[model samples]
Structure formats: structure tokens, C-alpha cells
Target: MTVVNGYEQSDAEKKLNILNLPSLADEAKKIIPTGGYGYIVGGSEDEWTLAENTKAFNHAQIVHKALSNIDSPDLSTNFLGIDLKTPIMMAPTAAQGLAHSQGEKDTARGVAAVGGLMAQSTYSSTSIADTAAAGNGAPQLFQLYMSKDWDFNKSLLDEAKKAGVKGIILTVDATVDGYREEDIINNFQFPIPMPNLEKYSAGDGKGKGIGEIYASAAQKISEDDVRRIAEYTDLPVIVKGVQSPEDALRAIGAGAAAIYVSNHGGRQLNGGPASFDVLPAIAKAVNKRVPIIFDSGVRRGSHAFKALAAGADLVAFGRPVIYGLALGGAEGVQSVFEQIDHELEIIMQLAGTKTIADVKHAPLTHFNYAD
Candidate 1:
């Protein structure tokens, strides 16, 4: 943790940190304890997919167009009807309280400071209304879960709308939690202080998973219930966690305003295709009917650039931001976004583009997988 002002230092000084998106992973590891760190940072066994997520970016060489009026790059864009100063939005990650005491409230402030959006996860430590208040009720996106009860699902959607959330994202990918081998081996649940998690679930008759005297929380929802929730939310509902082109199309046909292509940062379903690999075809299948967003393994300008080149309208990085929030609080989180946004500008100029429009359709060879 590099000390700036009164904040604790991140040990190793990171270069290209205008966005503080963890240019290095080890620095991120130092911020949180082994249990919390393993839950957020660890991936599947062998970790081949997690490793490939980063390695996939290395294979793409930026074809910089020199002398192309590289000055004044426009990094702003609108996502799901909400305008953003930068195309980068904070991807939803749960257990933020475990990252920092301020939890999602501080994360919300950081997103507002940058004029970007933060997707409030269903598992948020802070409730949706509180996060909305923290962002000064800035245009936000509420990420949803497929809970067992339809009435409970309806209530959450209604609550988000009343809170003035701009859009609702149905996280279709987590039909169940991902297989995080580290947590399994380490016996971690990223526990929250009492009365909070209990408050979130007391109505549903659930308790902590790792409690010596408690039981695991189960999300009991079927595919039919997912469509019902999608239909229930009037906001632009995005279907997250679609890795296959077919799944992406299904989400669109099922009434998704956008598709968030992610494999849960390779934490779930180890050995799945990196979000980058499936982006091109997924984008093509949607064909402008709905937006296509990509994440999982993006930690720098080049990563964002590659996602754009590969046809992602918007992108976000999870663990990197978590590290910033855990390490430095709101200011640290702002630094993460700033570092990525700054790198995005440099990458835009170097790639011979001025505005985001100039960034479209760089050619790429696709390696397809049958899922």
C-alpha cells in the first residue's frame, strides 16, 4: 500500500496507476486477510482459466495508428440508458464490508466521484437504499439474484425502483455460487459482523454458512422464475454471466437490455472461456438489439482496449477495485477508476483513436467453443 497523504502505502509502488486498478496482484493480496482475500482473489483449481484471463490480453498487440490526431480522447458513454463520464463502471462484487468497514457506501461514493455507475449486488453488505443515498442517488444499476420466492424477488425489484436505481441487472450466471477452490480449502465465507447479514435474510429464514451453530444459505430459484423477475423489473434489465453466444442470444430473446459476458473472473466454472474470447461472437449475435458488456481479467488500459476492439460496449474489473477499496477506502477506490480511465485515454491516443467511436471494429481472429 503506497502511502499518499495519510493513507497506508501499498508496499510496492505501481506504475501506470492513474486508475489504481491493481497494476499488480500481490499488492492487492496485502490489503485484506487470507480468508477474505482468498474469497475475492482466489480462482478454481489449477487456475488455468484465471491465468488465461490475463494471458489472453498479452496475445493482442495494440495496432497504434500514429499521427492520427490522438489528442482529446472521449472516454464517456451511456450504459443501459444512463450516461457515464467514462465507459468504465464498477462491476458488482459482494462482501464489500469485508473489503473495508465503509462497505458499499464508500464504493458508491467512489463511483459517483468518477461519474460512473456501481452495480449493487444482491449480496451487498449495505442495502440498496443506503447505497443509493450514499451515491447521492446517482444513476445506479441494481444487480439481482434469483431467490426462491417470486414475491421476495418482486419486493427487491420494487425496492430498487423506489430507490431510483437506473437499471436492474439479473445476474443469470450465478444460478449457484461458483466453485472457489481456495474458499473450500480454506473454509472461508467472508463473514460479516452480526445483525447485518441476519437483517438481510432474517425475513427469509436463513443464517450464516460458516457459523459453528448455523447452516448454509441456499438460493433456490429455477429458470422459469428468472424470466418472471426479468419481466417484473421495468428498468433496463441486463442478464449477467452469459459466456456462450447461445446463452447471450437467449438472454436477449428473454428480454435482456444487455448481456454481461463474464465467467465470474474465472472463479466459477474454472476452465471456461475468458470473457474476452467469447465477446466478438456474443456482440455479433446481439447485433445492436441490446448492448454487450465484458469483464473478467481486465486490469489495465490494454485490457479495456482489447475488450472494445473485440466489441464490448462497456467493461469493468472486479478484484482490482476491491483491492483499492480495501487498501484505501473511497479515495483508494477513486484512484483505481482514475488509473484505468487514464490508461484508457493513453491507449485510445496510442491506438490512433480520438473518441470512443474511432475505437470500433479492430479486426480479430476468433477461437470458438461449443458450450
Candidate 2:
């Protein structure tokens, strides 16, 4: 079979039939209504950073060793006491119900089937308990946007710990909303009840519905308050949306367990540096005191290699898994990772690496950009 992009596939229904990233993206674009796709796929106003995130990877190339006697590449890695067959994990996303009927549960099931971990968004359609049950207690992490009402965030943290979440990601990137022409043009909104407003806006969890929460946080929380919330969570806290080494150092100083470098899939503030551009600095800031995870513009498995080379302990996908879920629920989710593993295995062999640890700091070059 061939995709709309004119790429041939391995078969009709299986994931191998998806020849490339664009095919998967096309499938997702079809699954989501135009309005929703705007938010899921669109970049912020001007979209410079969104475009740069993917382009930044282009500056670097994965060098291959031709005759190193490489056998099978063990993609396995450990996260929070659980052994993951692949270092890949799904980034937290809000409102899976907006994409499919099964919602986060389907995504969780998909992650479980692949022997990977998933972080459930605070604004998820499936509540924490329901999502955990769907994965059958697979290693799951909860992503938090500090609520405007400090007590609400504390309550959420308590709930996450009670639910036995393996990790907590403090999502600190979006203090304010960025304009996506698609969201504005289509008038897209979340489907849940607006606690006090009529629109669906994604934000800090202080307001009732996502929209209001987002709008309120844009005005309420400051950097100092964020540091306080870091002191509150007992579970291993990972700070997501961290793009600068200074912020990375600050997070570590604030008692963060790990630094998750992400650009919000380029959905937030345009012209910001790509996650890769700052990964090395951030990794150094943590100085191996904690693990560092990277995300944004990771369309293929090879990008994971680049991230690993750049000192990221792990790499996560933001939209690819969502695209798969939008296409065929759990099956689609499974297919996305299958594609990743298949490509990753090939790269592992090409690079003469036998396991995730075998991937070393050697045999790579940092791409240079002329100003």
C-alpha cells in the first residue's frame, strides 16, 4: 500500500505500511477534525520556534561505523525502577478524548503493550485512576501544571502519589497561552465543562476548566511561586518545558529530581531555542545528579540517537503517538512505537551498538550554525 504522500508501505493495515513520518502525520490530520488539528499540529503565532525545533536536528548528523561487528541493539532502558524495552516514552498530552473515544486509556494500553512508560496530562479526559487501570499498572507518570489555587495543586499532587504514579513532571513551560491561528480561526475549545468560562483553554490548573485555568495562570503565577510548588511534591519531580541551562540549574537547585527539556512541541512561545540546542548545557547543569529527558521535533527513532548523543538520558515523543491514537486507538499507538523500534534497531546495528548503554559519547559531531 502507498500513503497519500506517495510512499509505499509494507502492508495495508500494519504499521509497516506507514513508510515515513509524513504518512503518520497525514493519518492524524485526517482523524482529528480541522479545528482540533489546529491546536494539535499548529505552531504558535509566527511559528519560528516550531519550525526551528525540527530544523535544529538537521544541523547534526548521526555518524555510522561501517564494520564494528554490531549485532542487535538493545533499546532497553530503566525509568523509575521499571525496565523499558525502548528508551522512548510518550509525553503528556491533554484531552485524549478530543482525539479518540478511548482517550488516555487507549494511549495507556498502547504504551503498556510496547513496554514503555507514559505521562498522563493533568487535563486528561481519563482521570488518573482510570488511566492507570487501563495500563494495568504499567509505569505511569503524572504531568502537573501548578494550579492557581495553591491548595488545588497540592491536592492533585496528593492524588498522584495516592494513585501510585511513578513520577511527577512539573510542566512549567506555559505560564501564558500562545496564539495558534488554527485554534483562533476554527474557534477550537476543549469539550469539558467550563468551570467558569465558555471556552477550552489549556493552562495552569487553578481555574475550573482548562481554558479558564490557562487564562488565569497567565496572570497569577510567578517564578517565585513555581519554586515553592517544587518544594511541595515528594515524588520524584521532573521539570518539563525547561529550555535554558540557567532554568535547568534553577530546577536542580529547587530540588527537582530530573530536568525534562522540551519546547512544548513548539506550541509555546515562538523564536525560543530548540530543546536540543540547550540539552548539553542543561545536562551539565544537573551534572549527572539526576537524569535528563528531551522532547520536541522527535519524528523518528534516529532523533532519539541524536538526543542521547547530546546527553539526554531519555527521549519522548509528543505528537507521533497522538497521531497513531487518532488513527486507530490502541492499535495505532502500538504501530507508532513499532515503527520507532524497527528504525531504532536498524540504527543501533548501523552504529555498531549492542545496547542502549553501548551508545557512547564517541562517533558523533555537533552541528554548527553560522550566525
Candidate 3:
């Protein structure tokens, strides 16, 4: 066995083939426990938004240009003043310990290995300092769920600053738990300790349902809260879970340095519009006021390319990374990113785009579809 990011990887895991990002979930399902797997993959209610998130990408087709001297297209870009080797980033997912023993620590190391960014969730299984140490100075963002207690929020922000986090992602949409029927069917409960929340938790929540824990969070989140967190942290605050143009503008007005366009991976709202479907309007509304980060059903390189054309400064994903962690620990996670990065390079070269900026201006044809 070899130790990676403080987790032991067996010889078999080291040799696991993880070339495909979408297929990793199947391999992971075999290893992760039933309840954990359900929680990771299941979406809210009917999962209509979940299915539509990836399907929406099909509606926007890239208009490939011919005869451009583009060889080895560059995928590197800067977001919120941080340089990245690839525009691809990891979205903040909670309770990573359900996927791997090392959890966010392994994820940080994998993202660092590939020169990518990771947003550690406020409810992460590992503490901020440990996750930062595992990254060894890789650019990272701390995603805040915003607890009901002001003292807890202040303490969390202080820890993030001490850990050298590059930014703060304030998630605002999931004030309550979505009706995830899969969890209901399987009677799922968070199995591992959320080190980040342990200090603030009122009591041992090992037996609490996801809904009960979510109920404890502050539900009356507003623009003032955004400004408060940004002012407190003194870091770039990214408002995550934004899907509307009006909400995008409101977040910016409330002192958000960046706007994250996501629908909680269709995990929060069941009947909502696909995150990609709403990107163009939000992008137009924001009009470059701040950087825009997008996630939700972004599975392929072509998907990322389309999102860039539609108006995303950076593209991120959550489930695939977890699956990678479940399959091969940090190395598996690195392979998932490497595969997408390689595919993106190929798509960029073929599409005659030499840089990420070129992709933004690349023409796209939208196909009409019935809602």
C-alpha cells in the first residue's frame, strides 16, 4: 500500500483505470456503501432538473471554425486573480468522507497535482487547515453555508483566512433540504463526522437526518448576509446557487466579487430550469461586472466549451470528482481532471480556438426545444 494525501492506496487502487470522468460513478457505486452512493448521485424530487442539466448542453452547439492555425490550444486561465492551468475546477461538495477516508484532503492534493482549483465545503469532513496543508499551497476557495450563529461564521471565516484560502463561496439557495426521495427510500444519514461543523453543532448529529441538519441552518439569507460575509472574511465572495439574471445582479450589488451559476447539481430544486439554460441571461445581466463560475451536469470537455461560449468564466463539477476519489483516492481524482483537460484541448484545437478568450467569442447555434 502507498500513502497518498494521508490515505493508504492499495496496489489494486493504484492500477485502477480512470480515464473516463462520466464512467467513474459506476466504478464508485461498487465500492461506496449503498446509502452513501444514493446521497452522492440522487437529486431532489423527480430529478427532472438533474436529467436536464446535462441534456441542456445538447441544445447549444458550437460553431466550429475552419483553417485556423491553432495547435496545442492553451487551457490555462485566471479567475478572481488566481492563475489556473485549466479552467476546470472542483465544485464544493459536502461530507466527502462518504466517498473516501481522506475526503477533502485527498481532493485538495488531486486538484493541486493537476494545477486546478478546489472549493472546500463548509460541511467538509476534514478541517480547513488540514485540507489546506494537503494542497500544499494550491489555490482553494472556502464555500460557506452560513450557519445561524454569527460567532460560528466568524470562527469559520478566520480559519479559512488562516488556511490561506483564496476566496469565499457563499451558497444561498439550499436554505432547506430538497425532497430527495432516494434518501427517503434508503433511509440515508450522514455516516461520518463533519469536522468543520462539529464545533458549531448543538449536539451529536450522527443520528440526525439531512433535513434536520439543514433546518438548523439560517433560512432567511439575504443580500445583507452576502455583504456581511464578504466584509468579515475580507476575501472575494462568490455567490453560489444563482440561476436568475436578477439574482445575479443583486448578488453583485451586495458585494459579491463573483457570481456562481448553479442549481446545486439539481440537488436542491427538482423542477427548476437546467443551470446551463439560464447562463446566457445571467451573463448578459451581469455583463462582466464580476467573474462567473458555472456548474451542474458539466460532464464533458465539449460541455465546458459550450458553457464558456455561453458566458462562464470557469466551469466546475462535483459528482465526477467524488467518484474519482472513491475509485482511486487522490490519483483517481487527478485522472478525472486530466481526462477532461485533455478532451478540452482536443475540442479547442478542432474548434479553431487558441485560448479560453477565443472560446468566449466562438459562435454557437442554439437549437429550439420544447420546455
Best model number under lDDT: 3
Q: State the displacement of the C-alpha of residue 313, model 3, in Å, after optimal TM-score superposition.
A: 0.5
Residues 115-155 of candidate 2 have per-residue lDDT tens digits of 99899887776777778889997898998876566566666
- Name the weakest run of 10 consecutive residues (lDDT summed) in model 3: 6-15
Using TM-score as the measure, name the better of candidate 1 and candidate 2. Answer: 2
**TM-score to native of every candidate shown:** 0.86, 0.87, 0.95
Candidate 3 C-alpha lDDT tens digits along 258-310: 99999999999899999999999999999998999999999999999999999
| Range of the 10 consecutive residues with the lowest summed lDDT in candidate 1 | 209-218
Better of 1 and 2 by lDDT: 2
The CA-based lDDT of model 3 is what? Answer: 0.88
The sequence of per-residue lDDT tens digits that candidate 1 reaches over residues 252-300 is 7777778888887887677787777777788888787888778888888
Superposed by TM-score, candidate 1 places the C-alpha of residue 49 at a distance from the truth, in angstroms, of 1.2
Model 2 stretches with alpha carbons more than 4 Å out? 1-16, 192-211, 218-233, 367-371
Local error of candidate 2 at residue 247 (angstroms) = 0.9
